[model samples]
Structures are given as C-alpha cells and as structure tokens.
Target: MIWCFLTPVLGAVVAEQYLGRVKTILYSAAIYGGGLAILVLSSLPAVQETVISLPGLLLSLFLIGVGTGGIKANVSPLLAEQCTSPGQVIRLLKSGETVIIDRELTVQRVFATYFLFINAGCLAALASVEIEQSYGFSAAFAIPMTVFIIGFIALMTSKDQYNSSAPDGSIIPSVLHALGITIKHKGNLNCTRPALEPVESRYQEYPWTNSFIDDLQTALSASKVFLLYPFYWAAFSQLLTNFISQAATMQTHGIPNDILPYMNPITTLFLLPLLDRLIFPTVRNLGYPVHHFPRITAGFMVCALAMLYAAFFQRTIYVSPPCYDHPRSPTCMHGQVPNDVSVLLQVPAYILVASSECLASVAGLEYAYANAPKSMRSLIMALYLSTVSVGTFLAMAVLPLTVDPKITWMYIVLAMAVFGAGAALWSVPVQRKEAG
Candidate 1:
C-alpha cells in the first residue's frame, strides 16, 4: 500500500519534469494493461502449480502500481483543467431566471462526477468476485484486463482531443533554490521590513515567480489541513477489512460475504447525485455556506457515527453468535447460520460512510486541486491521496486489536480518534486566523 501510494509522486515528478500528462497517461495504459495480463496469468491453476513465482507476482504488482501512479497523478488535474472558468459566472436562464455558476462548485461537481464513475467501475469490479466463484480466478482477472484494453484504445483514439500540461523540468531544483535563498537571508526575511525587495526584484534571484511563492504558501497551508486525513482514511479503511469481518458475523440472508463491501460504492453512487443535485443546491438556496471545511468536518462526524454503529454491530454479534464467546471459531464462519442480527441492519453504517466520502473524500479531491498552485497541483494531490496509505500504516499499529474479541475495541478507539481528528481539522482555520 505504501508503494502504491508513493509511486504516484514519482509519476507526478516525471509528468511535471519530462513528459506531459497525456503522454504519461498513454504510457501508463500499456504498463497497467501488461500488469493486468500478468495478473490474469498468475491466477491460472496451471501457473499457480509451478510457474507462479513470488517474484513474478511482486513484479506484476509493481508494474500495476507504477501505471496507477502515473494515471492517478494526472487524471484529476486533467479533469479539473476542462473547467476553464476559475470564478463564478452569472447566466440568464431561458425561463427568465438567473443562476450563479460558482467555479469551486463546478470543480466539486466534476470530482463528484469522477467519483460516481469511479464507484461505477467499482460496482463492476465487485461483480468479479462472483465471477471468480462461479467460473475461475482467471476469468475474474481477465475482466479488468479487458477493460484496461478498451480504456487504452479509447484514450488513444481521443489523444488529440484532451488537454495536456508540459513538464516544466523537475521541482527539486526549484525547491533547493528557494531553500538556499531562505537560508541566505534568514535574519532579514521579515514581512514588515521596509527595505524588502519588490516582487519583481525578488524574482530575479529566486528562480521562481512571486506568484509561485505565494501559491506555495497556500499549498503548504492546504497540506497542513490534510495531515488530519490519515485518521479519516483509517476509519474509512475499516470497510475494506474489519467491516466485512463484522458482516460475516451477522445474518446476510443469502448474500455473499464479499457482497457487503460493495455497499460502500453502491451507496456512494446514489449519494453523489443526491448531494450534488438536491441537498447541496437546496442549502445554497437557503443562503448557507457550503464550503469544503464545513463539509469535511461534518463528514468526519458522520464517519465517527458510522464506526460507532459498527462497534455496536460487532458487540451484538459477539453476544448472539452460535460460537458465543468463541468469535473466531469455525462454527461462526460464513455459511453457518449467522448471528441473530441481520446484515441489512448494517446499511445505515454503510450509508453514513458513503456520505462521508461525498463530504470528505470528494471534497478532499476538490480541496487539493482548488487550494494548490498550478505548478504543484499533482504533487499536492499525490500528498492528499497518500493519506490512505498513511492511514493504513496507522492501522498496522492496531493490528493486534483487529482480531475477533478485541475488534470491537479497535472500532471504538478508531472512532474516537477520527472524531478528535475531525475536530482538530475544523479548528485549523481558526488556528490560522490566530497565528495571522
């Protein structure tokens, strides 16, 4: 996971320094497809028996990671580039009404749409579990490989139609240059100094524009806000591992154990449209501020609530199971008569987390791009996305508590941690104001 998260920074560096976004993405498609092909081959029973080497599996994963890295670093910036308007535009409606098109909201909508399609892809991927069960692992792996091929073809056909950013050389030299200047004049660099160099004069020695410096400050400020995100992602990451375990302890009523994780994406699919179309617009109409901070803070609280519910769900499962005290016993496994609680009851928790994604995850994407300087957008976005890996790392510390009986406590502790992080996140702007 760390490799998966960190590889994108390398891609971002390559994109920002050498090849442009379009060519980088095109290059990634081939690598990504080849990796998937390798994965498909690895799943074959014949290959599994002899030819499936650990090095081969690791290499395939590495290729996939790099390919995803290039695509991940560029895709968001590319989508955001399509919305050329940077501020609100007032438009007269044909029906004699008026609407203000806010650029931030427009960007938010683009990300929402992006997430919708992302989850739509997830829905398709989730179906592959059933394919693996029904047909074979090769069939399941082949599905994504095929999709990657189609995507590669589509990208190639439309290569000329997309917007691309040229690599402006590496960011490292620029950073070192700034640091050298900062250290050289450390004693004299005061904002209120009367003899301070004019913005143009500063540029001559700095090797960067005044605007770049100012924007870098903004990017740094935004990056501080994201430091809290690992807690949020850690709480959310539960859905991938522990939440499914929780569901396995409950009555699925004929649903597959793997099927429950799909609820997150499925719920997200519905909530995106609800928030984008109805809920958010109504709030705006009512003269409320619908900015990123408020949305993200609310998301954290919602996520905390979701985990609280999960903790309770796990507690209930402990008491009602066939194994009783032995939560990990084979009698408690799936295909056995599940615990007294119905898996459908877990829906609210899924919905809450889904709302968190709409409020926090999608907003995080918009916040990363909207707040970042143009020169550092991909790097900043990569930093934001890496929070997932950070959170996963944090979860590793609590791995011992992830087992059956201690799992309830793990959820409780995580929920509390997230709530605290959310509150801290909410206080950042306040702290900034105080510092200013």
Candidate 2:
C-alpha cells in the first residue's frame, strides 16, 4: 500500500527549518534501516498457512513503507543541503557538481543505494531458494535477518557527505501553509488559492479563485515548462514497475536450485557500476540541458522496447515438459513445462532494461531536484517517487476500464508515457524561459 508524500516532506521541512537535512538523512536512514530489520525478522515465508501468515506479511510491508516514507521525505533536502547559493547551483547544474556527478562518487552512491537493493533482493532471489533447496524453510526465514545486519553495517559506515543548514528561518510555515491551502480547498469543486507562498518569508494575500478547474487549467497552462514537459520519468517508472514480475532470468542448471533468484542480483550488481561509471556520464555529457527531454525520451522508448523483448522471451523458447514420477498424474501437462523462461535470452533483455535504467533513473532524480523550488526539494522528491506508486496503482486500476486484451496492463503504461511526453514537450518552452 502507498503512503502519501506529505508526511516525510513535512518532517524534512520542519527539521531543516529548525534542525538540518544532514541530521534528517541520518535519522531517516536509521529509522528506515530499523524497519528493514523488523521486516527481516517477522516476514512470513511461502509455506506459512494463510490464516497465520497474512498479518505478518502485511506488517512487514508496513515496516518497509515506514522506511520509504522516511528516506524519500528527506533525501532531496539532504542533497540540496550541500549546495552553496542559487547562482552557484545554476552554474553547478551545467558543470555537474562533484558530489552528484563524479564517476567514482556516482558509482559509490549507486552501489550504496542500488546494491543495497540487489543484496536485499537477494534474500528473495537467492537465500529463499537456497533455504528451500538445501537447508529448508527455517533457514530461508533467517536469511533476511543476516542481510539486514549487513545493510545496517553498510549504512553505519557510509560517511555524512551532506552538511548544510536551513538558510535562515522557517521552511515550515510555507509547507504547512501549502497543506492548509490544499486541504481547505480539497472538497471545494471550484476553489483555488492564487497566492502560493510568496517569495518573502511572510505570507501575503494571494488571489483565491472560486473555480478549481479554472485554477488548475491556469496553473498548467500558465506554467509552460511543466505543461510542455516530456514523458520520460513517467514512462521509465511505468515500464520498470509494469514489468516487475517479468525478467530475463537464466536457469541454475547443474548448480544449487536456491541460487537462481540470485542471478538477478548478480546480473544487476555487475551492470550497475558499468552503467554509473561509463554509460550514464556519456549520455549526460552529450548535449545535456538543451537536449534534456529528447535524451530521456529516447531512454523511455528503449525501455518500452525492452519490455517487448521480455514478452517475446516469455512466449518463445521451447521448454520441454517435466517427467512426472506418478503414472496417473491427472494430465499434469502444464506442470511439465518450465515455469521460467530460458536464461540464454535473458541476458540481452536485462542489459537493455538495465541500460535504460541507467540512462533515466538517477539523471531524472538530479533533474527533478534541479527544477524544484529552493525550499521544496524534499517535497518534490517525495512527489516524484509518489508517481511510481501512483503509476503502479493506475496499471492495476485500468484493467477493468479497457477490458480489451489489446489494451493490456502494459498498454496503460505506454499510454501514460505518451501523455507524459506530450506534457513535457509543452512545458519545455516555459521552463527555458524561466531559467533564462
């Protein structure tokens, strides 16, 4: 289940206003890491009976949710905290800041964040299969705990690279004020607050429109940059999540059965550094800023093509039926075939998927942070991540509406990409003007 973005962004705003984002990330990471440990210890295994297992699974999900809430709520503010001035930020955006863009540094951060994902995923990918294959259920149950401890150690050793403070006074009131404005008008079909927190610290009277539709139209239409924005982030996230269950996975033939899931982790681990160090910088360096939308658009479309490859991979490649020991197996025809697709074809599909990830994922993060209002970095990041959650929910939700098989779940994702691309194109003119 998705949690709203407001909570963590609010926390970051308050803490940065009164405390600091560096401290926020430290505290955020701690709380999130703590939740990971809980999920590790308590999450139910595949064998657990439904009556006794559902609650634990839900609880584990809830704990992971807590960490997501914490990390996303503050990460943008934490990164932005490292910067000096707005003018310097603009220049740094073009030049590429050492903190965000250095090859070694980028690799390290990607390893820290993404490798953390892979290693954690390995619990499901490798350890579970391992436990099931060799040690049995209890060992699989225990694997996540071991992995969590490693994560804890990794987080503990990671240095505090971000060290900056709130500019002067409050970021709290504008955030709170924005929330109040949002909520007070939430049910009002036609209400709009023209005065979004003023440039000055003090609040000023803004134009409050009675028609919400008119106000929304004004915002998108008037804000040309956002209106014209391309569909890159929307498409990238949609593709990855839409095909979450599908992968170009190879078999663990002649090896222990339990380690098959580990293939994904291993493959991911090997590719991430290559991506961060070589592919990402090359793409970013090739006529960025001016060709920003097009670069990301190419990434989005490539990812779509990868999904098509995965679908084909799943369909083709003749997998022979399993030989049942039972003489009267009640026609176990489907059971005879391999549940997974062949690994020989999985490599290139994953390469395509991973490369697309490198092209768009982190670059988009940097892009969003660059575009946000000075004080609303964390909020924007939360919203950006929230789109992933929203896009996922939409995929499931649209199944009933389009009922046509031609318009499958992935089609919704494709459609969203198209919409986002249109929006981005519309918004670019305005954004460039604002930047200029």
Candidate 3:
C-alpha cells in the first residue's frame, strides 16, 4: 500500500518530463491490464495448486500498484486541464441575478463529479467480492480485466480529444536552482538579482522568468496546506482496519464484516450529487460560499466526529454482554460469540467518514489543481497523494493499539489529533486570506 502511494511521485515526474498525461494513462492502463490478466490466470485451479501462483499473485499486485500510481497522479490534473476557463466570468441566472462564475468553484464541482464516478466504479469492489464468493476468484478478476480492455479501447479511439500538455523540460533542477537563489537572497524571492546580475558575474544563466518565481511561490504555499492531510487520512484509514475489526466484534447477522465498509462508498454515491447540485449552490446563493479550506476543515471535523462516535461505539462493545470488555475471551469461545451489539450500528460512522471524503478529499484535489503552477500540476498532485502513504504509516504506528481494550483509546487519540490538525488548518493565514 505504501508502495502504491509512493510510486505516484515517480509517475508524476514521468508524466511531466517525458510522456504527456494521455500517453502516460494509456501506458499505465496497459500495465494495469497486464497485471489483472496475470491475476486472473494465476487464480485458475491448476495454477493455484502450485508455488508459482503465489509469486505470480505478488508480482501482479506490484504491477497493479505501479499502474495505479501512474494513473492517479495524472488523471485528476488531466481532467482539470480540460476545463477551458481559468478565470471568473459574469453570467445571468434564471432568477435574473447577475453572478460571477468562479473557476475555482467549477474546479471544485469537476473534482466532486470526478470523485463521484470514482466511487461509483468502486461499487465494483462489492460486486467482485460477491463474484469471488459465488463464482470463483478467476471470474472475479476477469470482470475488471474485461472492463479495462474496453476502457482502454475507448481511450485509444478518443485519444486526440483530450487537451494534453506536452512534456516541458524537467522542473527539478530549476526548482533547486530557484531555491538556492532564494536562500542566497535571505528568503526574498522578489529580488531581481537573477535578471539584473551580469552574465559574467554569475555561475549560470537564469533560465526561469520572474513569473516562474511567482508560480514556485504559489506551489510552495499550496504545499503548506497539504501538511494537515496526513492526519485526516490517518483518521480515515480506520474505516479499512480498526472499523472492520470493530464490526467483527459485533453481531453481523451473517453478513461479512468487511461488507459494512462499503457503506462509505454507498453514502458517497448519494451525497456527491446532492452536495454539488444543491448544497453548494444554495449556500453560494445565500452569499456564503464554502471555499476549499473551510470545506476541508469541515471534512476534518466530520472525520473527527466519526472517530469520536467510533470511540463511543467501541466502549459500548466493550461493555456489551457475553464477552464484556474482552470479546476474545475463551469463555466466549474466543470470538465465536460476538457481543450483542448489531454491526449495522457501524453505518453512521462510515457515513460520516464518507461525508469527510466528499468535503476534504475532493476539495483537496481541487485545491491542489487550482493552486498549482501549470507546469507542476502532476508533481503537486503527487505530493498531495503521498499524504495517504504517510497516513498509512501513521496508522501502522498505532497498530499496537488496534487490539481489544486499547482500541477505544486509539479512536480517542485519532479524534483529538485530527481535530487539532483541522484547527491548525483553520488558523493558517492563507486560509484566512482566501476566506476573506
């Protein structure tokens, strides 16, 4: 999983320096399809009986991770780049009120819609799980493999339709050079020393313009906003790990414990359109637009609330009958008898976390794209995506507390940590500047 997140950094550089977004996505899809094909073949009964299947499965997963990283880093920025308008435009509403359509708002809605489709696609997970259970692992793997083949064909037919940026020269050396210049000038980026100095007096010619410096500053400022994301992601990670474990301790009524996490995507599917079509428009019409930072802060708060609820829910499970405080007790047959609590009760927490994804996760994508320098969009996005890897590490650090008894404290700590991060985000001067 960490490799899945980290590979995007390299993928982004590849996208920026050599292959354009469309080609990168195509190549990545090809690699991903190959992995899926390998997976499907490896799951066949004959191969499953052999040691080769294990290595094949591992290799497939690694290839899939690499492909996923490449796709993730490029796709969102590609979508954003397709939007023609980059500035505000005045338009008349049906109600005869003239209003300014902000490109930032359009980007936000685009990302929200993008996220909606992503989750809709995630419904395949539930379907695949059922297929694996009923048909076979090979059949389950074959489904997505077939879908990817079709999707790749569609992309191939429509390749020229996308608005793609050509690979500019690599930005890494330029960024490093600019940073050195900034440090030499005692952190003053506005100085014209690069342009004004004689060529003979300097070790190298300044290849970047003054505008490039401005863009670099914007990218750096945007990077600062991403610092809080790891905490939010760390809290969100519980949905996959500890949340499933919590469900296992409760009465699932013959349902799979892992199935409940799908509620996050299910709730997101319902909420995205409502937020995009209704809530945001209504709030904007009321003269209070929820900008990206406040919207993300709201997401952080929602995540914290989910954690708080989970903490209380964990406490309830601990105090519930049969196992009482220790669900794994041998007296209760070592988790054979779960607590009397119904697993359906976990739905609200999942819903809250889903809401946070709509708010924080989608908005973070929009923020990254909108604020990034045109040339560095993929790089900035990869940095934003890396937060998930960092958050995974944070979750791993707390794995010791994921066991019974300590789990409740884990939730509490996560809640406090996320809320504190959100508060810090809100207090950021740039957030205030944007809000004002």
Candidate 4:
C-alpha cells in the first residue's frame, strides 16, 4: 500500500521534473530491474554474510516493492487512457462489469497462461537444480532483470496506437466535471419533483448527529455491491497464501529439497489446461450467455477438493523424517504407502494443489476484473490482489501457530477452501440470468 507513497507522488514529480509515463515505465522498470539485480548480487552467501544483514535485506525488499507497486498500479490506467475509444474504455469497463462476463479478456489471459504458466511450471520443475548449480537466488533474480530490460526495450520500440483522453484529459478538471455532473443530476431530480420535499426538512424531522457532522453531510453513501466483492476475494486471498506452505511442510518428509520443485509443477500443471489448444475454444463457448458464476463456482469446487487432498497429505506424511531430510543417512522422512515407498508419493498432493490453483487463481483474475465497477476498476483490481496479500499475511501469521495443535492450520486451509467453494456456489445464481 505504501507503494503510492513513492510511485504516484514521487513518480508524478519525476514526470513533471524531467520525464513522463514512457519515461516512468522505463525508469520504473529499470529501478525495479536494478533492485532485483542488487538483490541477486548480494544474495551470494559470502556477500550476504558480510554486506546484506537481515534488516538491510528487508529494507531493500521494501524499497523494491514500493517502486514496482506504484509502477504496476499506475501503468494500466495510463494504458487505458491512451486507448482510442470508449470501446477500449468500454472493454476496460466491460472488464469490470459483472453484468458482462468478459470472455475476450478471459480467453486472452487463459491463452497467455497456457503458454506462460506451463513454461513457468516447466522452468519451476528445473529451478531447484538450476539455482543450486548456477548463481543461486541472486542469479535467479538477475535472469528476470535481463528479461525486464528486454521488455523495456520492446515497449520503447513499439509504436503508440491509441490516443484517447484521460477522463477529460486532466485530473482536476475531470474530477470537478464528474462531480458537477453528479450534483446537477441531483438538483435536476429534486427540482422536477419537490414532492420529494426538502431532504434537509426530512433530516430535520429525523436528525442524527455525529462529531464529523459537516464531513458526513458532504459525503456520498457507498453502494452495497462494493461490499460483496471484497468479501469474496478476501476468502480467496486466504487460501493460497495460508495453504501452500502448510501443504509443503506436511509433504516434505521424504522429499528432497531439489525434487520439491516438481511437487508444485505437478499440482499447478494438473489444474491448468491439459492442452493449450483447448483453452480458447472452451472460453469462447462460455461466451454464449455469460455464465460467469457457474464457472467461478466450478473453480471454487476444484479448489475445495484440492485442500481435502492436501489435508490427506498433511495428516499422513507429516511425521518422522524417515529418509530424504537425511539424504546420506539410512532413515528417510517418507510416508506410509509401501515398504518401498519412494519420494514420488508426494506427486499426487502436488498435482492436486496445482489443479486447485489453476481453477481458483486464473478464474479469480477474470472474476475480479469482471465483477468490479468501471471507474473503480484499477482500485478493485488492486483490491483483488490485496486478497492474496491478506492471505499471505494470514499465512505468515498462522505459521507460528503450527506448534500448538499442529493440526489447526490444516483445518484452517480446509475451511477457506470450503468457504470459497460455498461462496462461489452461492454467487453463481446472481449471475445466472445476468451477463457476467
């Protein structure tokens, strides 16, 4: 959240003082890229012990997070403003319109995921060995920085296509204009029919007071729909962040640190489209009546199942490191499947988790954007992401609690997964006749 403390305010200064959005993206990317580079360089064990103390490392992480936070938050709004039509705005608007389930965006993202996620999964499969043998964490991050630089170069080279106005081409004027339109609308309504009586007279008849009476008088009341979405997403945010580490810890008995990479790949790939070709057409078919809730519910159901699968893994394999944790020793931290139970038993659980992730997360992106209102799209999108932040925050908070019942976190994930499924199932009927 503090990302705004730097990016919008500081970036606004940078834009005014010397550069603009193009420069902002470039420099933001560079700063972010540079931070990643520094992080990688300093992660070298020798360098870490000497130069990067834990506090210093955390501070660097915070700085980097702040820079990227502002960049990403502002970038999409900038892009939308540059589009030529309300068609683009409409499309962006449509992205947030729960009444119009966004199939095109859904198709685009799913297709992108088919390629990107699988490749990411594949790379993740090889990541552990690569990290150990290559430059470790620093080198891992450096690789992405190189990619970011290339990305910056590509963005710079690309020609600008759309030249749309920014909500009236000026923030102050735009805000005033919007507010004026709203006020004029209210005045028109009241003037046409004074049977409405003086609202102030009504207030006088039933007056309620507060310390901030003046402020309350001026403010607009919020819509009820705004309350619904954040609730749905909050459930989601809790799931992945809380569950993943717990699943990992429970399954780690016989698992080699190196082989652990495959666990996630196994899980995620299982959830993703088995074939890239199937994704677009499947989504295209869903475009018929915009049955978004059903799709979202299906995703949630899968997520719930994933946690049950995890519960099984946690309950069974969470004890007595029998082998793998002691690679050189005779005893292994293995499970109770067979006399010759190999490390491979963990694959089922990983596959289960991955399947759940694909169902929950990908749809979640589509759901969040589709469900939000137009003017608040970016903020709502951030709100969707913030759920993950909340979930991760919950996870970190819950991590230490494992020492208690040691079984509580398992049930917690199960509850989130179940609650998510229930919520998604309930929301389905709302959009059944609606566009989204």
Top model by lDDT, which number? 3
**Candidate 3 residue lDDT tens string, 75-98:** 999998887775789999999999
Per-prediction TM-score, please? 0.88, 0.60, 0.92, 0.60
lDDT of 2 at 362: 46
CA shift of 356, model 1, Å: 0.9
Q: 262-291, model 2: which lDDT tens digit per residue?
A: 444565566666655676457557844323
Candidate 3, poorest ten consecutive residues by summed lDDT: 427-436
Compose the digit string of candidate 4's lDDT tens values, residues 227-341: 3333333333333343434434443465544454355655555445552336535765777433345554555565555555545544544433433222222233343322222
Cα error, residue 246 of model 1, in Å, equals 2.1
The C-alpha local distance difference test score for the whole of candidate 4 amounts to: 0.46
lDDT score at residue 123, model 2, on the 0-100 scale = 40
**lDDT by residue for model 1 (32-77), tens:** 8888888888878878887555556777898999998888888998
State, as a TM-score between 0 and 1, how close model 4 is to the true structure: 0.60
Winner of 1 and 3 under lDDT: 3
RMSD of each: 4.2, 8.5, 2.9, 9.5
Q: Which stretches of candidate 4 lie over 4 Å from their true place?
A: 1-27, 44-56, 71-138, 159-255, 258-276, 279-290, 318-343, 371-374, 396-401, 424-436
Candidate 4, after superposition: displacement of residue 372 in Å?
A: 4.2
Task: Give the range of the ten consecutive residues with the poorest summed lDDT in model 4.
Answer: 215-224
